[model samples]
Target: MLTIGVLQMTSGVDPEANLAVIEDAAKRCAKRGALMLFTPEMSLLLDRDRARARAWIESDAPDRVIESLSVIAAKQHLDIVVGSIPVAAGGGKWANRTHYFHPDLGPPVTYDKTHMFDVDLASGESWRESNAYEPGREVVTVEDTPLGRLGLTICYDLRFPALFGALGDRRCDAIAVPAAFTRPTGAAHWHVMLRARAIEAQAFVIAAAQVGRHEDGRETYGHSLVVDPWGEVLLDMGGDAPGLGFCDIDLGRIREVRAQVPALANRREIAKS
Candidate 1:
């Protein structure tokens, strides 16, 4: 069994402050025998203003945040997956990018978010992510752990079933869904959707999330979770304070579940009308 840790945090605008908390959580997780650690989207900073975000966000790959995270991962000898960072993608657009790092790897493999949350919520929480960011084109999967293949995705991507299907088709043993889901939607659909994905894909789901109110006064749902292929929630951080949750997993269960259900082979192309 492999131990995975999910870090739930409430981050503000200061990268330094955020890193301090994250590093502390990493140490705690490492102490608990976690070989892999995952953090939420906007792990470094959470700001409502796009222009202000561009000021601290970087265009190059090796920014202060990424560099610091790389050093942390190397020092801890932990496989780290940090949720979306606002990457300067030119023309005043930032890419919501995810980073996967290994202890001995030179640099992390970046995964830009393909799905943007462009809807207006019932609570009047409106997000025009496309207004400030560019969408990614490819799905990224890497294998560095005993857990086999791992796929990466960001917040809004959770709503789309096809993305998970693509990941499952690639024989991904687990999917990392790092999110900063707003309060209303998260209260309603978060648990259901996450569990559905876990059951359908027959893969372990690790979702580290941003919770509580931000400096921008935006309230987030803070139930960071880890679910198994059988749709069992292993750990759930209930509030805004930074915390880590562990889940012991046997990857062989993935094969056993998939074979018993045989869902992946059940897909069929539909005839066009």
Candidate 2:
């Protein structure tokens, strides 16, 4: 069994201020004896301006954000899972990438978000993430302290079930869905979708979310949660300040649940049946 921390926050356009809050939360979680930590998506900046967002992307090998996080994780001797960072991947395209850094690892490994949230809301809040960002081509899974084989995913990908199936097939013991979900959609389907992923995959689902309003006046539903293989919520924090939660993860439980259900091996292809 291993202890994990989930940090939920209300991030905005200021990177410095957000970093300060994240540092404090990480310190607190480390103090509480957490071996692994996960932060919410957009944990660095939350501006709608495409120009400013583009400027924040780092071109250097050791991006300032990753460098700083590496130092912190090494100092604390903790495995840190950074939510989402704006990354440039050639052709003037930016990818919303999530990173996983272990204490001994030289550099953090990353997974870009595959799904872009492009929705036309009835309330006039339209988003075209694809216009500013490129979708990722691969699904990534990595091993870290406390969690054996962990799958990484960002906010919008939670809506797609095939992603979870892919992770399960890769033998992911836990899945992290770091998000900055908008108020409307989160209120409508967040809980159900998160729980379903945990139930179907039989893997621990750790979701750290962004809450409150942003500089763009866009409200995010912040309810960071952890669900067990049985689809039972272990921890739930509803729109509170940045904080962490702890849960003991049993690596053996993943194998046990999969063996009991045996659904993964039973998957079949339908051919116009």
Candidate 3:
């Protein structure tokens, strides 16, 4: 069994303040004997104001936030999945990117969020993420982690199954789905969808989520979760506040589930009409 820590955060516009929270969590995670820690989407900054956010987003080069996280990972001797951060992707656009930092690895493995959240909701909240963010093109997975082969996905990508199917095809032992879901949509579909994804992929799903109201004037549904291959929810951090939660993942369960169901092995593609 591998123990991992998930940080449910109420991040703000200030990257420094957000980093402090993460640093504290890393210390606690290390003390608790967790080998890896996972954080929520927009872990550094959650500003909706493009003008104000532009100053913090960096292109190509390692930004201050990334550098800080790298140091934290090395210092704590803990692998960290910084759920997602905003980085300049050229053409006046940014990428919602995930950075996986390992203590021994010099540079982090990165994955940009594939699907963009472009919607006009009935709650009168409209988000056109494509306007300011570029979409990622490739499916990304990290090999030989504490959870075995781990796949990466961000907030909006959870709504799409093809991505998860590709991850399942790759035979990922675990998938990280860090998110910052809106209150309305999160309340309606969060638990069910996450549970379904875990069962479908036959892989452990670790989702560290944003929670409560933020300094940027938006609210998010928390409920950071860890689900097993059998669709059992191992941990649910609840929707009330932000904190660090830990879950013990039994890697052997992956083999057991696959042997019983053989979903990934039995999967056959249906021809398009």
Candidate 4:
């Protein structure tokens, strides 16, 4: 069993403030023997003003948070999976990208968010993600990691099972879902969906989430979770404040679950009646 860390945070408009939170969490989790750490989406900054956010990104301007994380990863000898950072995409748009840094591997692997969240919720919560960011076309799965084979997905991507199916097909042992979910949707679908993904894909699901209200008047549901292959909720950090939580990722348990069910090996296309 490998120890993994999850950072539950409520990020705001300031990158520096967010970095402070991340740095603190990183040191604490690393000290606690977490081999790898998964942080929440928008770990850098969450600004309602897209214009201001875009202005923060530039070719010369550094992503200080990621830079600091890389250094922290090396110093602590830990693999770090940063949630998502907004970077320059040019053409008057930015990209929501996740960065994974290894203790030895100097450069990080990046994955742009594939599905954009452009929905108008019934609870008066609305997002126009397409207006500010460009969606990614390729699916991503990383095989080389301390926590076995891992898959990456952001907030809205959690609702789409085909992506998780793709990851499972690639034999991913676990999936990381970093989200800043709205309170309503998080309340309704968060727990159910996380468990479903684990059960359907037969992969461990670790979700690091944003909690409470933010500077932009956005309130995220806090309940960062870790679910095993048997659809068990291993850990759910259910607090209104920022903190660190950890879970064990047992590859043998994944093997045991798959051996018992043999679900993936029994794949077949259903015929339409």
| Order by lDDT, highest first | 3, 4, 1, 2
**Candidate 2's error at 183, in angstroms?**
0.7
TM-scores for all candidates?
0.95, 0.94, 0.98, 0.95
- Candidate 1 collision pairs: none
List residue ranges in candidate 1 displaced over 4 A.
Answer: 58-62
Model 4 bad stretches (over 4 Å): 270-273
Report the C-alpha lDDT of model 3 over 48-156, residue by residue, as the tens digit: 9988888778533338678889999999999999999999888888999999999884789999999999999899999999999999999999999989999999988
lDDT of 4 by residue, 1-273 (tens): 779889999899988888878778778877888898889988888888876776677644446667787898888788888889888877877889998988874888888899999999999878999998989777787777876788998989999988998888888888889999999999999999999999888989989999999998899998999999999999999957878888877789899999999999987767889
Report the C-alpha displacement of residue 188, candidate 3, in angstroms: 0.5
Q: What's model 2's TM-score? A: 0.94
Residue 3 displacement (Å), model 2: 1.1
For model 2, the local distance difference test gives 0.84
- Cα-based lDDT for every prediction: 0.85, 0.84, 0.94, 0.86
Question: RMSD in angstroms, all models?
Answer: 1.6, 1.9, 1.2, 1.6
lDDT for 116 in candidate 4 is 95
Candidate 2 displacement at residue 22 in angstroms: 1.9
